[model samples]
Target chain A: MLPVFDVVLAAAILVSAALALWVRDRIAAVSGFLVTGLLVSLSWLRLGAPDVALAEAAIGAGLTGALLLRSAHRIPCAPSKALPPSLWCAAGALAIAISGAIVWTVTSFGAAPVYPSLVADNLPESGAQNPVTAVLLNFRAWDTLLEIAVLFVALTVVIMVAPARPRTAPLGPLVQPFARVLLPLTVLIGGHLLWQGGHAPGGAFQAGAVLAGGAIALGLSGVIGSKLTRQNGLALLAIAGLAIFALAALAAEVLTGALLGYPAGEAKTWIIAIESALTLSIAATLFLLFFGPAERH
Target chain B: MSELSLLVLLPFLAATLTVAVPGRAASLGLVATAANALLVVSLCREIIARGAVEQVIGGWAAPLGITFVGDGLAAVMLAMTAIVSLAITAQAMSTPGRAGFWPLWMATLGALNGLFLSGDLFNLYVAFEILGLAAVGLTALAGTPMALRAAFDYLTAGLAGSLLILLGIALSYSVTGRVDLETVVVLTESSNGRIALALIAAGLAVKAALFPLHFWMPAAHSSAVPVASALLSALVVKGALYLALRLSIEGGAGAEFLRSALAVLGTGGMLWGAWNALRAERLKLLVAHSTVAQIGLIALAIGVAGDPLQNGLWTAAALLMLSHALAKAAMFLAVGRIAEALGHDRISGLNREELRPGAAEFAFAIAAISLVGLPPTAGFIGKWILIEGLVDEGAVHWIALLLLGTALSAAYLSRVVSRCLRGGPHVSATAQRLPWRSGDVAALGLATGALLLGLAAALPLTLLEVPFA
Candidate 1:
């Protein structure tokens, strides 16, 4: 039964992904992608990676879908002109060859779990029961910090390059009521996810993305209109995470005698504190990425 | 303090500050870049003062946790990135239509810093995405039809490259069960895992604009605004090349085959790029194509791994990258000024009849000399080390190719230099006053640094003796 479920989910994922790529209509393709993300999340759950499944659901299905939908609405959904027969044939052949190569390569990969013993040995010292969190927060904290930076940078680029222009029309009626109901619940859920990251299947990134989703919902609903002017306070709020993290690391050097080295026994507390700060920052950064630069009223 | 964490965080803090300080965009941007530069300099000093700085993020040690390791290689790259970024920021501030350039530029700076410092596979992917998006935005900031078209093509290419990289990362993670660089390095001892590493390298090479994968580069770089072109050509592409180098160093014997493949591609790129650059009709396009050739040279140097004689080759590549960054940025800025004065950038159609010998023209000559690997310049030093290494390795073919590439570069660059030098009786009367002394000084300073860096190579080379050595 388990094997059957895996097969079914895998099949669904493949079909949806293919449709997402092949569909001509931008909106339809985006919906196909959303479905594909859902299937991928399901597959992650079936594989016993609930944390990854959570991330897939929030980031893959939720945030990415929203982004695609917004972009699709912003840009006209024009289809490309048909390619000549020879070019079409060549493209098809190339696609088939690539698919074949990918399949062959994936099937040929030998099973190897070299890091299991290492992860198990270090799991205790990592101050987290969940290996994923241990890996994400402790073992690979540099990556996470930089990933936060990536989000921050992306937001900055979006704001700087695509400055918020004045919108002619206000939000439709449906969006305001929807946002009013959804925003608080989203904030609550996001807080829970962030707080639960150490022991369970939620973390700063997933939580932050969720928080951004709520903020975006509010912004789109005209509760927060696109103002043409920049907000200094919001800008400062956006960078709070990075500044806090760097300061914490600097403090760590003074307290623990190494950069980013937490106090030995109080590792969990420090990790949580850092994670909490990161969560707020991540949320703000993601919100900025979505809303762009806040325009003046 | 771990050199790695500092390397990543410094630019990030700057990026955040740049966006946060809303009213004074230019000053905020400058402060961010300047702060990052100071951090990079300090990091370099630390590496030189100590050995390589290694930190497992969150106090988690390697193989189980993510690690940030900074060696001589990373330090040099970071320093170079800081320098180029500072110069570009200075230039961008004075350029027209620079209202939105600072924030995106800062973001790009942060992403580049992250790319250089990251020691995990997934983290590297995230950085690549950030860099790719920022670069695309920067490309589009020129706000011309040509710039938009070029940016769109660049965006598509960048996305495709990123997807390939993502696929490679997923495959590697599946095989190794960990995303940490050290863990993957340990796992690559087997032949079965080697293939996954190769896929990752190929994806990286595509983004690095090596040879056949560089189809989107010249158009994207040449068509954008001058500062944008400089950043894209000199620094943005180097992020991927730096990754390729890091992977080759960490992957051990599993990467040998991949390195050979890179050598082939690099040679192809060098020859092809040089040939195209020579035949190119536009001055900016010529410089852009020359960048392809220069990047190819660096890749080739990196690919000639595992030989005892070439143990110091990475330093040579680093120096080459630095020289290229400075010279290229200066060239682009000079071209911007020249184009502004002459009202066009077409090579053959440059109004030599009306041209005057000024700061822009002088800066162009200096940049051209450095670019063509002339004496006393950093470019010459880089070429010298490469040629010396090639001779020691008995790689006559590579040496010949290098010499040929250098000659072609000189020929193409000299065309612009000579054109600017043509101050005959019929000089143009409509030349506008060059608006920003700071811009010219920045270009001149960088061009001078390119030359001065060669004489002071010992300082940076001393820092290269980290884990790799």
Candidate 2:
């Protein structure tokens, strides 16, 4: 019965993904993508990775969908051109064959994972209750640092290339009032999610995405202007995480006699400090990506 | 602190300051690049004295995480990057028409640094993305219709390359269950894991503009401003090639098939690029096409298997890259001055009566000599080592092809050089005397560096043999 439920959710996700690709209307396609993300998140839940499920819901469904929708509104729709039946059939056949091969391979060769016990053994020293967060923030912090740099670079490129300001009208009156009421509540919830991430299925990324959502809503409501301008304050805010994380690691070498080794018994505090900085930076970065460069004073 | 971390951070810090400084763009650019060059010099000193520096960034342990291991190859490349960037910055400062050149250039510098020092596969991807975007931004900075079109084409190609690389990363991660370089090395020893490695190497080769994958490069590099062109041709393409070399060395047998494929494509690129360069009408276009040939030669050197004799080839390839960086930047700068004086860069139009021989023409001659692989020049030293290495390997066919490519290079470069030398028909004319002195000095300095560097090979080679890896 449980397997059937998992299959149903996976089927729904596949169907939604197909619809997202097949739809002619850009707005509808974005919505379809959102549905696909949600279904995928549910599938992750079924697989017993609730932490990933939360990340998928927040990042995949919520933030990515929002970005797609915002960008879609800016893009002029192309005239719909139907693909030839032959091409469509060929694509469908290819997809089916590939997926079938993958399924066959996985089912036949699947073995019990070897690293779970290793992760479990080292989990306590990582200063995080959640194994995935421990892996991401402690054991593999270098990847996360570089990932943050990637986001920063992407933001820079978008600012350099994209038009500074949209020519469209500001958010309508109806959306403005609602945004004001919801912004604080959203921030509160985002903070909770971030706070709970060490022990639960929420982390800095999910919290940051939620926070970016609030900021984007504010921008859309015209509370924040759409002018592509450089805000030095915001840029500094965005860089704080990287600076703090890098410095902390460097400082550890002097204090602890090993690089990236936290001072004895202070691991939790260091992790919290890094996560807090990252949360703000990640939120600011996502907001900048959506808003483009803020108008320079 | 390891030299690798400093090498990566210096440009990044410079970029941040460049953006933070509130001033005329040229002044900011000058300060940032000068500071960056100074940092590079200091790093070179460290590398020469102590060897290559390795650091696990954020103090993460390898296999489970990321690390940065700099060896002799990385130090030499970093120094080359610094020299080219400094020369290009001087050229940009002299030419004041560009508005947003400095920021984009700084970003490019930062991206190059990131690419050079990164030891992890995923970090390299991030570096690629950063470099790709910055290069595209620089391409579009010219703001001409042709430049915009070229930039868009470049952007399309770059995005496709990046997507393929990302997909490769994802697949590799799924297979190995880790994204770090050391962990991937362990996992890739198995035959089944070779497929993922091949995919990644293929993706990187496309980004590096290997032969058939180089269609977008010439157009993008040729259409940009001279300073921009110098940077793009001399530095940007090298970033991806550097990453490919790093992976090949680290990946061992898993990458053998991919490396051989690169060698074949590189050989084809060398032949095709030289053929086109020999016939190119525009001087800048000729230089741009020549970059394809040069990069191909470097890739070929890297593709050769590691052996006692082959190690010299690696050093020779490094020297080749350094020489090309200096010679190419000089060529571009000299041509920019020529175009300014003559009002156009059409190679056939140099016979007009009003054109007078000046410092620019002299600079062009010196740069051309280096490009043609003349004696005592850096290009000659590089080619000589390569030829000797090939002879040791009994690769007579490749040696023949290399000589042929050199002859073709000489043929094209001499065409431009001779035209600049010839006295055109005299006319009663008052064309403004070319502001050739400063630009000429910059070009001369670089060309001199190219020549002198060959004689001082021990310095860079010592830097390249750093024990960080």
Give the DockQ (C-alpha) for candidate 2. Answer: 0.31
lDDT of 2 by residue, B273-331 (tens): 88888888887898888888877877776776343122546666677778888888888
Clashing pairs in 1: A139-B65, A139-B66, A140-B66, A227-A295, A227-A296, A228-A295, A229-A295, A229-A296, B354-B427, B354-B428
lDDT of 1 by residue, B1-469 (tens): 5445555655566555655554577777787778788888888887887778766555555555555667788888888888888888788777654545666777788788777776778878888987887888888877778887788888788878888878777777666666667755654665545656766776787788888999888988988888898889879999998888787777765667777887888888888988898888888898889888988888887777453233766566777777888888888888877777766777775546544557777888888888778878878888898788778879898888778878888888888777666654433456565655678877887778887877887777787666552
Q: Which stretches of candidate 1 lie over 4 Å from their true place?
A: A77-79, A84-111, A114-128, A163-180, A219-235, A293-297, B1-4, B28-50, B93-97, B182-191, B251-254, B304-315, B353-355, B424-430, B465-469
Across residues A187-212, which tens digit of lDDT does each residue of candidate 1 receive? 89988998788888998878888887
Top candidate on TM-score is 1
Q: TM-score per candidate, in order?
A: 0.89, 0.88
Which candidate has the top score in lDDT?
1
Worst 10 residues of 2 chain A by lDDT: A105-114
lDDT of 1 at B200: 77
